[model samples]
Target: MLGFINGFLRRRQRERLRVAEFSSYWLEILKTNVPLFNRLHSADQEELRWRVQVFLAEKQFEGCGGLTITDEMTVTIAGHACLLLLHRETDFYPELYSILVYPSSFLVPVKRDFDDAPGIVHEGVDVLCGEAWPTGAIVLSWDEVCQAFSDDRDGTNVTLHEFAHLLDMEGGEADGTPILQDHEHYREWAKVFETEFTHLRRARRRGRLTVLDEYGAEHPAEFFAVATEAFFENSSVMKQQHPALYGELKGYYQQDPIMWLSRSDPVK
Candidate 1:
């Protein structure tokens, strides 16, 4: 009984926080820093604002490598993250609690096996701009996030890529599948994704310039994340080049980013 009461109280507190009005400063940051914000319909923008407020209230942000966490930084990050949550009934990434930001690309340890000696292994470092752990946290480089905003058509947003992983992991694992509306949606998702993933791999082997990043050929999870980036950042090309895949992403995200592009101008 006590545990139930505590849970209820916490839920109530979070609801109150979500209802609270957002700050004007945060609004300015979205207006000035995120061009995507301008492309959203007024209703979607309002919804994004509420989602951002809830996200900022719930998640912790920390700076690394001599970077300082500022309102601008938090709002910018929150805004991009909330874009993924806009049309979905989400708990705002309930499993993710923290975001760690770096000034630029950071190094992480990776393991490799020796070809000469099967039993021997060594640790190497990989320079990365972002990573999304299954449940705990997301790490990002602020430089990459800023670059995404400046060059929106590049189909690369570290923030979107990481957050998409969070979505993929919502089902207790990150195996390229996320929570769907029903079993039918799941079947369709699996079918379309597998077909497209196979096609991408084949295209890469043949040295074809695929619409999605070749990095997606690495794994199914990576394909989902990379496709999400292309879906939002380079929707026109995605819609034209890969119609079926684009339809699947459109159905999942519930937003036609191509429409947003049309409203602004032809995406070159």
Candidate 2:
């Protein structure tokens, strides 16, 4: 009798916790790229909110200086970051617990070179709004993130770009690959990525325009990151330009944004 009573109390407690956790709607997840806000299906939006709540329970956020980081701010960041993980199970570095944010533009060190240069010297610091290194360090400028959410340009989303880098780095190397499930997946991935990478490189060399950014031609990793951005934000264009690549991304991400676009006339 006592065992039955304890089990019932435990189940009740779990239910109560779930209800309390999801009762709030004004979560930071809502402050996303306006397009993402309008494009997500109702179910996805609810899922995002739930993920944000759970995410908030897991991650660590540090507001450098005396800056105040609200639940809204943390949720806003995590919500978008979670979008990359929505379709798959990704265990990003458990060390990736800290998120460093600045009030505005921050100075980060970088390498630069003049003409006739294969290698660059550590010239000075770069005035960047955001940067993400594969070792679980992410730097953000709050101002730039806000502006990026509002900007309608297809060319960029700093947070998305940086987070995409993290995804690409989940594999042994940050060489534009996350972990794949099987050998068959790896074989297919290699074929698709190499073919697509070659195509983009040729396009950039020939001065041909691409749906994804030409900066992708810089390296294998950049190609993957840029392809990811196009896959999510400008999905139809990605589909129109590279059907195979789009199909592969759809397979990996499970969510077809092209379908989302077609379903909602207001989103496009």
Candidate 3:
């Protein structure tokens, strides 16, 4: 009875949000800041707007480092984050409850324990553009967010990178593999990803330029995020250079950016 009541309430809330007014100003922000928005077909664009509406209503945004949250900031962030949900069953990033934005790159303190030497720990500080926490929070550099979306071909979006981590965590951990549609898919996923990940590491070590960022070589989790950035932003190059990897992502995302780009007016 409790589960049924919650389900009904959720449906009612989504119905209301779906019919609410969508501002023209928010559309303008997408046009100006998020280059990928212009490439989406009209139907996909509408679906994205609907999802963003629900997302904004559910998630909390907090400004940090003397920054003030604005309609532009939240809307733009929501727009990019929702792109990951297009054409998929989504819970609007179920584990994410808050977004904390900073004015620019911020420092995070870190502690590392040595494995070989007992009782030895090292503390350090690292600058980050974005981070997703297991505790239902995401920290981002606002300036980096804007800059990343400004160039859709760069294959380096802080918003997408961080949000991908949320999806990975939905199954209880960030293991570079997300829950797929079927149990059988895991075998193919593992095999293809391992091969491609090895290829990336080799390319990085040999100083060869590849479509995926070398940072992806850091871990399977990071590889998934970096591959996602490339899948959407650098679709054509990735499809050509890494056809198998592209196939895996294309199957997962269910949107062909190359096709979208082909039909849309040329991106300036």
* Highest TM-score scorer: 3
TM-score, cand. 2 vs. native: 0.80
| Tens digit per residue, CA lDDT, model 3, 167-224 | 8888778989987877898899899999999999999999998999999999999999
How does candidate 3 fare on TM-score?
Answer: 0.95
Q: How many Å off is the CA of 248 in candidate 2?
A: 1.4
Model 3 alpha-carbon drift over 4 Å, by segment: 1-3, 114-119, 264-268
Of candidate 1, the 10-residue stretch with the lowest lDDT total is 259-268
Candidate with more favorable, higher lDDT: 1 or 2: 1
Overall local distance difference test of candidate 1: 0.88
- Tens digits of per-residue lDDT, candidate 2, 1-268, equal 9978976875565345444555344442463444575567777766666555555665678786566887666766776777766646654334476788888888877677767766756478888887777667778888877776776347466677778777777776778776765667877888999999999999999999988899888988888878887887788778998999888778777778777666644432
The digit string of per-residue lDDT tens for model 1 on 130-159 reads 999975899999998888888778888889
How far does residue 173 in candidate 3 sit from its true spot (Å)? Answer: 0.8
Ordering by TM-score: 3, 1, 2
Off by over 4 Å in 1: 1-3, 114-117, 265-268
User: In angstroms, how far off is 95's CA in candidate 3?
Assistant: 1.0
Better of 1 and 3 by TM-score: 3
Q: How accurate locally, in lDDT, is each candidate?
A: 0.88, 0.72, 0.89
